[model samples]
Target chain A: MGKLSKKEIERVASLARIKLDEEEKEKMASELGAVLDYIDKLKEVNTDGVEPIAHITGMENILRKDEPMKKPLEGQAADAAKLVKMAPDSKDNFVKVKAVFGE
Target chain B: MIKDNILIEGEKCTAASKILENYIAPYDATVISNLKQAGAVFLGKTNLDEFAMGATGENSAFGPALNPHDHTRAAGGSSSGSAAAVAADLAVYALGSDTGGSIRAPSAWCGVVGLKPTYGLVSRHGLIAMASSLDQIGPITKTVEDAAIVLNTIAGYDPMDSTSHNGELPDYTANLNKPVKGLKIAVPKEFFSKGLDGQVNNLTQAAIAKLESLGAHIDQVSLPMINFAIATYYIIVSSEVSANLARYDGIRYGRSANKAKSLLDAYLETRAEGLGAEVKRRIMLGTYALSAGYYDAYYLKAQKVRALIKRDFENIFEKYDVIVGPTMPYAAPKLGELGDSLSAYLADIYTAPVNLAGLPAISVPCGQVEVDGSKLPVGFQIIGKHFDEARILQVAHNFEKSRQ
Candidate 1:
């Protein structure tokens, strides 16, 4: 059975880019560990010859014809505007964000 | 009626997540577009588990959707509101997304009919991405015929969703009159194993017997790999979730954190405040699994096991027309009954396997069980091979008609 230590939880939390408080980290350490422990049973299955598949649908390389755009948004300014307006901080057409690096 | 809530222009498609709270969709999802062309009236969006992550509706950022049958019981979820609405006659039918039994579980718990179409059978272009490969938009309705009608409207290929199947779709309701007489049905012994409540088991077995009386041939089969379904389903779902949810970085759309000094801080703080505990847990688990050193051991191994699980279904379907079992191992649990995340994941055992195999399955109300003075609904699940929805729907419709 695999157990996630608090440190490992913190590390994974960082990778996920979600801030977790001390209490949450502690809870996740045990809860997630229990789940992983259950999942660890998969190691027992002999999957030597099985090929991993991404999706069950056997379709491959589904390419569509590059047709001229019908432009559903052609005369719909409200729709295009609504798309940008969803952003918390949006200007004319672009969304504003904090500086990536401190000066 | 579209559970495929993507960019429904000028409408809020939150997936019940606070992160996407107040985020209005910018364009119509393909399903919604199809429904509109069919002259379907849009009732309204139903509530769900936040980001469609939890099995119980308790994970909804707003509040858990109560089972219409019992106010204290949970409407099985992430499509919690969809099922509850139809169950209560609040809506004629509603659309719901299912990754691992989101639609069926809730429908079963709420005592309604729910259907999860074959993967790529419906367009995913406008639906919010959960576990992209597993996430499917489906219908929760009052009857099997309604499910078929909604499916007829919403299914078919769209150039927008590359994975969408390009084929001539059948009018699902056309086969409603087909009799189940002589239809071969496989009942996997694993579905009746430990963890299934005794009453639920009895009800399901009786439902199977009823089908047999209708002339369906039933056989007991073993699917040894069934044990690995939940683990494999969670691993694949989480990995895909980690990748899909990464798009919500605050700057693009959705709720953003204020007073962040750097972009990194903005990303972390926004998600921490916006996402719920279960969603965060899945993201972290997925991130850990997909992380460099653990990738081969966890993600790749689960995928291989997934292939085996799929093989199990293929082998069974070779001999049977559809597989029948209880949609849920038990009747609806009271709200907050499932305290831990792992327990909730385990409850998905029977439902998850169908998703892993990209098969079509439906949850039809079989009967009711007495629980704590309440008559809780039991669901009988019928799973069919890939693109074999008509066969299953035929069986379900006949079963439902016979009960009526």
Candidate 2:
């Protein structure tokens, strides 16, 4: 739980695609550090050979058939029309997207 | 108003109905079929934090769900609308997803009963995943009994969700009146620290005292990792969310940017616009945490810490039958007063650790805190060991009945 460096914070922000101001970066660094420092306290516990319990109910390897099925809207113009009708904001037979690549 | 009509009919129950119009259940969601046969009408879809990435209802693309209890305050989310629907009597009960308190936090704020059953007790098939390892669907209802009944219907092994368990299904509602005469309850000391509102603190203490009078043993315990629960939760949840939400590319069911000549541009623009700010923040945080260089430093480390947090509860449960605490540090904050996204994220502090541990925790209205003569409901959370939902319900039902 080392202190989060400025470069690390910037990198994280870049991955998140958020443009953080200096104040925000500093604040996040400090807040994230405090959080990490607190979590670091777990090192004290001895988890020797403790089989990590990912799912609790004790079920494992639930298998299902791997058959490729047609989409619900497949070959049903009515379903496609219904989808278009229900879309909150759609245009030109497609859902719209914001400009990200230098529109 | 539109949501109210839909809930009243008990037909067409499906997630994202308003956006999708039809009751098309997601890949493994069983709630659709279960709700239909139970005579519960599905209202046209209510909005959620896209991919269930938010803790405040404000992250929905459709609109923020107003708290039925205090319209001015936020309804806790990603199960925001579900809680709101129940709070407003829009539905007798509504299903909600809990990955780190989405259901319980909002349930607490909205003054309704929210139950996040033992992880895997409920199926996660139809849920749009935020963090795959941590998500579970449970009921938001007006009464503890309603929650139990809903859990009875939905809690079982589902072949669709690999995470679903095949454990014995107990009749949670049948034991509502069972005497909690000797239940040992632990009250975590870390939960009652500063940042808790005075009124909420007093009300919670009173609730504990009342429970004590009801033949339950209330003891003070320390969950060492409890203070770090939020940070660890965010790191792990965001990382999973980053991966889970990557599937919503424009090529699939969700909206895609058409004008973009290239696939990369399409994905970037579509996600940026479709997702709300909080969703974006989590996705970014997740991506950062899971990235190559930071994986060990952040994501893996969080998992290790998560194990410790789980151990804390496991150790405590060895001595106590159930654990109780204030569901939120304070009652629902004013809707816009959270001011920034970080503040809103912190609202989940009280509820997230239970999710990290994958335990069953329920929020029941314990008392009311009056702010400016407006009575805002406060909740008390009763958490049980993994797969101990029946006992958890018994404890909560006993508390609710005794208070009545």
Candidate 3:
């Protein structure tokens, strides 16, 4: 519906780097198509000469001085170790990832 | 209590996703830190629609949380478990995020009070981002006063969040008993049109009449642009999701695609295996909307429409102190019953616009509708101007008091 297709979904999923199986892909295609069809209703609205709002706060150029807040961690090093363990693969307090370039 | 996504240190913030099943929050979110400072005890995390993506808890990696009110009905979500727990007396109150009615819908369904504060009124530093521009963490509780208490503790400026507001925080409780006798309340006519169940319409309108009897002046107002809000909301939110969720590759925290063949495969595999069906659908929607060739057509257009929607609310607030409506079109449907994504999204018709407008709104249990001989709670939504949460809270607090 409204130009959304399986091929299109596959293309977008690749861009997001998400791997969808055939079943999930099919379901997503139909669901996304329906959603797009609904949002397509916006075409009727005239947003002529309107400035797009990125944030509702209307605040911009917020800058803060470089200052570090103190952390009085009880067993700080142990806590740091606990946090580091959150990584799926880790070694020596460093998170390990698959090689980027070399095989 | 906690939602699956918001980090609570020493607890797993799985976000009801298999991907983050074992992922303990490395640190507390800013709200958690504030709650801890306020002497709040920590409870275990609860379920939500995966990554706050769905209208019902059915999308959770853990499956839908059963409604405590009726076993067959839903505990309306993405804050499914938060609302469910508080409804079941598992916790006194809980926190929920409203991207598109996540907090308010469930609170309504559970017959409790949930407030979606004006955006940036609360710090977003440690809370996980669903849509950076739309998401606001608020409280789901048993009463409006408790909601105010939570907001008072959590609402303030945080340097860590660039979007955080710098306004002077007010004593939300101070206005809980203030006179609402002369306040102006506008009920948007668009909210009462088709797609709203007739029974819910009557219940919501009767609640408005009750308020009128209590001395608040009420009027029928029209927000012609309301029809465009959900469409605009989905576009902008999904677009932001595509960007925010990209950080979930297998490299760092959360579940990683194990024994990967390549880095590319790792990224795909982890996201593929970790996220649920609803999340993948939204991710694809976001990805396609933000794709190079279509960005202008979908994302930019949506933002422009967002300005119009926001302007509509601002114009209304010029004459009315608050806007009243049904929090949702109907009472919570039976669990596992919202058959499709589009159907579920439609359920948020009345609530999502507030998020798009970036205004403060609250859902309080107003009346019940009998469905198949069983009674379920319905909610009355009251929306206020930006940073004017105190006024709405006072309205809700007084209304709750008046009920007793």
Candidate 4:
């Protein structure tokens, strides 16, 4: 309902961990503000007693067995290796990144 | 063309983002597995909006997929390339994911048949996640029967996707031979409001009249909560998108920001550089909505409104077999015509609500309109109840048969 400031946009982008350049920041601030302002109409609807419908299908807590199928599991493992190998740097069968233990 | 976002095993599934340009799909999604078992060929992957974020074809990182009907216009997206490919006969048929209106909107613009199956009716295993709760992979084809054929191949239970329906699958083509006489159809008045183009409204009404003449009953229905659809859809989807897209940190896969000075920079810069403008925009908005202080106001409220939208459809389906309306507001806009994200978001007015309710809806070409010196196709959408795909397909097929 309230207007979004540039600072708020930047903070949200940071929370999302997606860096926005100066131009993108102002643009995003305005665009998201418009969308936010538009959806502000939700406040007009009195949802005081309504329960939130998270999924469209009424099914809840669908649990497949934890055991994996061998064929697809192997295939998925191979694909995971291939994806890992795609990173900028991979060593010893893993993607290598900047050392996590830095000052 | 190589894909920007489709998940073909070991193939690039960039999802039209700089971040995932190198991201190879880890395995075949459940739908892809079904298609493979049916002996479907691997035509090269087509284009889509980055992270499946926009309404117009203009948002793809690769560039807009041109409408075959009017080259100067968009192909309608985020299933832009799939619809255009089918329209142009570039592929026999193509798989498209409809989170909100991606499948139906593109089909309308391209003059094809696109079916967004009941949310859980089709498996979402291999399809790249857009908005988890709303996304469903469906088919875009040249005919209703063809759409039915593709649906038959892909619809079934897949343990891989916990959301996949465990119900018995039907031969979608089996009911195409059935007639739709005496079927009750409702036209939601909210869908025909002010912004609907006059030509489109006329054509849609004409299509309904023709349906009436075919022995089906048509009635104008009021769904008071219809006005809240776009607002509710954006809030819920953006919130989910923010959560789903967070896995794109540099370490796992996709294009990593090797230049990051620290692990946190890797997350920030990778997403910043890899994602497109519309995608980043949704992420920011979603993040803001889900933030601790604002969650109740935006995300939770949207879900409650979503419940109301579902109830509206439920009440209508209680009387009518299917609900009919125009798919998009009008024909495809000229490439780059909608200059802002809000306009594109608003453009999805008619299509998104069906997704929110998790029902099956199909866009069948009703007729064409001469606009801006070129002929553009108009689509009429028929929405059916959950898991009631057979009836809608039968209705659409009957309509298709009547026209011919």
Candidate 5:
């Protein structure tokens, strides 16, 4: 495993969308480096011709047929309103967010 | 019955993180719905490690859940509160999500019965996502019989969860009194290595000896690939966590940042302020593994090695009915005694392999080990083939009955 530099940590943090301070960055550089170094042991195993398993259960293509609306999906309008109301900013039953097109 | 905060719907599902501390669940988790249908009463939600990331309960944003045996020691975690509550007699039983020992470790540390069902046997719908592939919800209870009963109610398929198993399930509580006579049990040599505490090793070996005297055939087996289980588990778990947690981008319902200049800033700042340290660390590590240029080395390699670990168990199960061992390396440690996170991850060696293979395993109280003058509980783990909850539960049940 390569040394996890501060800049690399920052880059990963950016991809993850979690900001880290300089001190946290330094700590993660070492901590994540150690973890990645440990994970590097997988290289010892010969996985030649072995297919990687994404799901353990053999079930595949579990297709559910499109059925008619089952009693309007059970939730009352009050529940819908309450769920929509949970957002920090909302109006007219829609969650409000900053405009995608920046000014 | 108590439920871990990770299960969603009526109450707040904080998952022991500040980001969703006040987030109300919009729907009942499939397991919760199953329990309710069986007339199980809710005793309330319990604390856990943030996002079910840590092995010890210390990583909770609220605070670590204390061990029922010793107040200063940590209850084993991620499902810490549930195990502690059951051990402390605060609830009859509780539900906990296990994605690499979240249920078993805490149950072991707190001296309660915790069963991590085969993946997809219990639906993950409405449960907060930690690792999509390895996660399963199971019961934490005071007795193996109670764990069996709870499993009977909650084990089944759900249309809502595509990964849900549609296979038939046996009555988990039906064979509680079944004798272990003629049952073949394998004790993996790797689980009793030098890393195991001396007292814990003695107690676990004694427990196996007792089972042997009860007419069960016991033999030492080798699972050489077990050495790499923790490394593979962390890589896969972190990679999945980074993807699953991307849903909490401040737009939907979680904590939002104040006065964000742009959507990107809103996401970065909200997570910065809301997520706990361990959660962020996992996300960073996960993102790095799944990032450009490193995917093959970390995520993909881990998955292939995971196949080997799973194969080890499959080979053993071809002959043995179940594999038994100590659930943890040692008893619960003092609140902050786990030291660095790396050491904690390494301690999960025994339990991680079960998750990687998506097998059913239960941790039943074996006895206690004298640690620092305190008699802390040890867990005897019984692992079975995929979807063989009944066999493991029956073996555990007979063991529990024999103790009386």
Candidate 6:
């Protein structure tokens, strides 16, 4: 658990596909390091033979009907469309984007 | 009567009047029907962290919910408006979704009561999803008893929500008057460490002392991994958030791109434009964590860490009836003054582990912290074993009663 380096932050940003400015990368490095440093304190605890409990209630293998159920009407679709239509770049019932795979 | 008329008209204005003006309850969240039938007045949908992505209400597209206590300070969020409404007396209680301290953090900051029930206790059927496994719908109110009342109404099985529990419903309000004599309460040594604000720590200690006077046994317990809860929580939650939010592809629900040159363009453009910066950051982080080469390094390892965190709680609960801590590391920071998104994320450091461990936790206003003659409330967090909210409330209720 060493500190997060500039390269790692850039790698994370690349994987996540968000272009980060230099300042953001620097801030993230420091902030993430502090967080990891804090989390490292967990190593002090002895958790030998303790069964790791993902869910507290001890529930397992929740079974449901395999049959496809009727899709309920989601009232949000029309509203969301209206919202999208209001965006500055929307055109032809679709959202326009910057050119991909350059000309 | 005028207020009642306003509420009735508001309900009629939309199919579900739970959300404030901007948000349409795109789906029939169970809270809608419950609130309508309970005669709970609808006062428009309240603002929240977009898709509940934040701990402070500042993340909402609608606008940051101003803290009623101190307008300049933040109203702790994801459930920001809910807590604000309760504190301002705008609504008796507002429905809030808590994945990791969305409800509790704001409640603590806003001087209200917020409860995150045992993971499966409430149905999340219509509530917007943010990390399915960790999300639980809870109540934010001015009093512990009011929270219990709301919980009683909302807690039950829902076939529509796959993760809902089939367990028998417990009458949460019925235990409000239960005695707290000899109840074992553990105050984790790590919770009171150096970084915690002295004033907030003092207020929390006072609350614990009051509980002790009510015959509850107080002991200092150690939860060393409690510190890692936030980091492990962020990796797992953001990973799930990225996956869950993938459905909003301009085809189904939520804002979608209007004219897509291609299907892929529609997805990227729609998401890029529609989602706020924080949402984008989380999705990207989650996508990266779950990516092919990094999945084992980040997501899988985080899950293992999550297991270790849960084991810590289980071990503590074995000896103590409940664990207590300050809900937030500090009193609500001033609005526009919390500094960065990362700081806001750490605000949940005190609350996220409960979500990761799938336990029940509550935030009750124990006392107020005053800065420069302005006062904001500090909350005492009471966490209990799975499905053990009854005892948690009993202890919290005793503390509340003693304070009065």
What digit string (tens of lDDT, one per residue) describes model 2 on residues A1-103? 4467899888876655445667767766766665556545545545565555555444576665688645642221234555554443568777554444654
Q: Sorted by lDDT, highest first, which candidate order results?
A: 1, 5, 3, 4, 6, 2
The segments of candidate 5 whose C-alpha lies over 4 angstroms from its true place after superposition are: A66-68, A71-80, A101-103
Q: State the weakest 10-residue window (summed lDDT) of model 2 chain B.
A: B1-10
Clashing pairs in 3: B4-B15
Compute the lDDT of residue B141 as modeled in candidate 3.
Answer: 96
Among all candidates shown, the one with the greatest lDDT: 1
Q: Which candidate leads in TM-score?
A: 5
Instruction: Report the Cα lDDT for residue B328, model 1.
Output: 96
After TM-score superposition, what is the CA distance of residue B296 in candidate 4 from its true location, in Å? 0.5
* CA displacement after TM-score superposition, residue A32 of candidate 1 (Å): 1.5
RMSD of 6: 5.5
In candidate 6, stretches whose alpha carbon ends up further than 4 angstroms from where it belongs are A1-56, A67-103, B1-23
lDDT for B139 in candidate 2 is 88
Full-model lDDT for every candidate: 0.88, 0.73, 0.88, 0.86, 0.88, 0.73
List residue ranges in candidate 3 displaced over 4 A: A66-83
What lDDT is obtained when candidate 4 is compared to the true structure?
0.86
Better candidate by TM-score, 1 or 2: 1
Model 6 has a DockQ score of 0.19
- Give the top-scoring candidate (DockQ): 4
**Mind giving the per-residue lDDT tens digits that candidate 5 earns over B1-404?**
55455454668888888899788887777777777778878878998999889899899999999998999999988799999999999999999989999999999999999999998998887788999899999999999988888888988988778899997788987877889999999999999889999999999998999999999999999999999999999999999999999988888897999689788889989999999988998899899999999899889999899888888898998999999999999999999898889999987889989999999999999998888799999999999998888889888988888888
lDDT of 5 at B93: 91
Error of 3 at B5 (Å): 1.8
What TM-score should be assigned to candidate 2? 0.82
Residue-level error in angstroms, candidate 6, position B50: 2.0
Question: Residue pairs in steric clash, candidate 1?
Answer: B7-B27
